[model samples]
Target: MSSARRHILIALDMHSATDAGLSTLVSIARRLDATLSGLYIEDSQLMSAAGLPFSTEINYLSAEERILDPEELLRINRLASAQARHLLEELSARDKLECTFAVESGKVAIQSLSIQGCDVFLPGRSRKSLTRKQVTLQLRQLVLIYENSGIFERMLEVARLLAANGMVSDITIVSETPLPAEITGKLSIEDVRWHFQAVSSTRPEQLRALRLNSASLVLMPKDLLTNLTERQWFELLEQLPFPLLLMD
Candidate 1:
């Protein structure tokens, strides 16, 4: 790892901005001697819809329809952002790390990828559409998405760091091939519990089989998603019920 300071950016949404995720990021920041920051995205789609006279909202429980007030949405956005900032501040203070946060108006992924200086960008998970239960962040089962590239090492390094801070019982690499002996040997010597799951390919379906609830963190290389269109990118995220550590 470089001795120079790095910046870690976390993208936040209303449903998934939990303290557990923020604490994990703060721990990583402490390990890397990096600064921490957050981006709270106000959904552009909802905001635009509010401008239309026909836009209305239905209560999921009450089945009642009402006009979608832009003011109400803006108020909700500000409240969410403030709550996120409060969580970050509380963790940063407890960890003795400097942290900051901001609000952005756009799609979460687009706004997240637009920022260039962050060494690690965590694209926040929106509320999952699937009926499966969501898992809280646990650093024990570290999961890394493998690409035949140099980014795996970086992913492993971050995973190991999390292991050191938390009780990481096992590390799993989702790759088509086994890791090089050099890396595997080090893990063995360190007595770290680890395993590999072989896949025929890195197709979306194969990747999706490794469900989000079982792992503590999913380390995905940005290059693997470089070819994904905006819609495709969102589809992948929607399936993930946990925070995704997007490695650049």
Candidate 2:
């Protein structure tokens, strides 16, 4: 058995929802004997805006007059918090893994801050709407997404394939700096030292060097690609040399 504790961070939201994301996290955590952390960012702006009451009770309303009210915001926050807790509990129960929850108020990017010592990030993939600018930013390590319902099985298959081909021995999970709170809270370099041979610096150049030297395949959740324009998508494709396994 591996001695290192694998760490994973999950982004909790309403659309893609938390249940599926937590399910994936638990599965991965169990396989790696890792702990999971759940983060729910309460975008002050979004919450504030969504809290507004409708201008009129009728269905048709003027766009300019529509505004969120405090009651609405409270309701939304309650629902989001409930979902986040439910997921955390479920994952904790299944794997006997430690879990933590955070509800912060900030921009989406700020809320998505990295957890220190995390090996991977599991985020939900949704087709509803995309944040164009957010998708362009470079993120560290593997970004697991729910492509279809069967993504977990696919990942297992991929891991098995790599193991069979002797490629698994060379693979390692890496992350950028400012790791998530949950990771730093529960683990240390000493804990992971045996399982991961090296820790790459957070710099882009260092990351590139590590990827070239250590990894044969880089995995990311398909949702990371959702909001990109064709040009952006092609650019990302060109930049990556390894075959990306897009989890469904």
Candidate 3:
């Protein structure tokens, strides 16, 4: 089994979108025989902002301005964090997954620093409906999105890991141009399959189109991701609703 453990930082709040993606985390953990850890951020900013004496929000349901208080915010954070821990324990234990969870009190993005040593992980949630069969993505849809060979080897390494765990059915290498044969031939993970496709001219638009339903996991070079601003990152995420593995 591959020792490349995948850390999936997710919110377990019943009302949060991450709660729905919890199943995907379990599936990946079980398949990879990896440790599945969860982190729930007790956002301090929300509490801090609400603590302002004049802070108010028009409650969408009631259309009434609601005053905020520090005491009540603390109470809500405690309750939410507790619920998240309980849910994580129950679900993870049910699957016999080696799971651990932590609560960080800060911005959602900054909390990810806890897993900085990880080689790869799901940094956000994917709304793509996950099924038991697709846990390891048996759909044979593994897409590596990139522009060059600088990180092609790393992409193939991750793909091999997926194959080792039987998390991949087939792999698709999507690039701006065709990759050299010597590089393509190196993607030989036993009993695994893959193919490559290069777009003619446009890249971003074509890439978005391919991401819609072309793959279950989009593997990308971590450095390449820097090309996107935070907003663009989430926008691309919305397009590719499936899990994304950003690797070094």
Best model number under lDDT: 1
lDDT of all predictions = 0.70, 0.45, 0.59
Query: What's each prediction's clash count?
Result: 0, 17, 2
**lDDT per residue as tens, model 1, 155-188:** 7777766667554667888877777877665564
lDDT of 2 at 70: 61
Candidate 3 ranges with C-alpha deviation above 4 Å: 1-20, 43-84, 94-96, 113-115, 123-140, 147-151, 189-193, 199-208, 213-215, 233-240
| 1 versus 2: better lDDT goes to | 1
lDDT of 3 by residue, 1-248 (tens): 33556554453322232443565556655664556566666667667888777987675447898787778877876777777667667778887877777776764434453355443444234444455444434435778785565556766766776688766767887777767778766877788777777766433324567644423667775555545445564465445455555554
Cα error, residue 245 of model 3, in Å, equals 1.7
Model 3: how far residue 125 lies from native, Å: 4.9
lDDT of 1 at 62: 83
Compared with the true structure, model 1 gives a TM-score of 0.82
Whole-model lDDT, model 3: 0.59
Please give the distance, in angstroms, between residue 103's alpha carbon in candidate 2 and its true position after superposition: 1.2
Q: List the lowest-lDDT window of 10 residues for candidate 1.
A: 128-137
Worst 10 residues of 2 by lDDT: 136-145
